[model samples]
Target: MKIQEIREIIKLMDQSTLDEFVFEAEGTKLKLKKHNGETRPTVHTSAQPQEQPAAVVTPKTDAPKVEAAPAEPIEKQESTSSEASSSYKTITSPMVGTFYSSSSPEADSYVKVGDRVNADTIVCIVEAMKLFNEIEAEIEGEIAEIHVKDGQLVEYGQPLFSIK
Candidate 1:
């Protein structure tokens, strides 16, 4: 019924082995199905009567590939400068959204390279459906790299930061 409840259902589905889930409450119906192994699940919701088509809310998990842009150069530079032997864990986006480094444009970024973070640390915000969700590090480590640029439209599960 609420966004939090829906999010919890998604989280549970992701962690479990089930590939599909359907629920009907009151007059509303919800159906969630995961596609490919690496893809985010799709959600379909509809009210009774079935006159109108069911509303499908699919996250923008993939974008059309385009030619190299100016931003690629910076990413290349960062990758090249990093040590080849460094071992790190990447923090990926849990949902598709526009990635923001700070709560506001004037505020300092939540984390940067060389900054240590724990599971509770809010490293960034992902704005979806006009709601800004704070994304946590979920692991204990020092940030080693940032893979996405600020204000970039990111895909679900896309790497955001690497930690060591």
Candidate 2:
């Protein structure tokens, strides 16, 4: 997507009541959010084949964070997956929100390293706008790694777990 298009998206999101907006097409993922009444955007791209900026911004900084590192999962997760860890697939967040490893604080984590999971298994939860969204394994495998911690903020497309 062009910067103009992204700017337009920010404008639209700023005007709407929705606190967040996500757009993904081809190999690029764009996330925008309204926080404390401020409009912030995140950009995530992978080998797009199209010319685009590797705009990395942080919520605290004036950058997009590349999934805005809301995943900061964007930084470590990227390097974590790119180098020396190509054998496993990852479970990425479908939306931006707070990641919870269990149903509640007192509950046991949904899955841990070495745990086997089927495609439909609920491995975690992402809370967004007071909604608790169950994050499924989506792929059958044993949990190889947990990328994000419980109660941590995660951006769209940020990897939450690595499965082998």
TM-score of 1: 0.55
Compose the digit string of candidate 1's lDDT tens values, residues 76-144: 223543453457778888776899999999999999989999999999999876778899998999988
- Stretches of model 1 off by over 4 angstroms after superposition: 1-81, 84-86
Question: Number of the top candidate by lDDT?
Answer: 2
Q: Least accurate stretch of 10 residues (summed lDDT) in model 1? A: 68-77
* Best model number under TM-score: 2
RMSD of each: 13.9, 9.0
Candidate 1: global Cα-lDDT?
A: 0.70
Expressed as tens digits, the lDDT of each residue in 55-127 for candidate 2 is 3333444554344222222444563544337778888887779999999889999999899999999999888
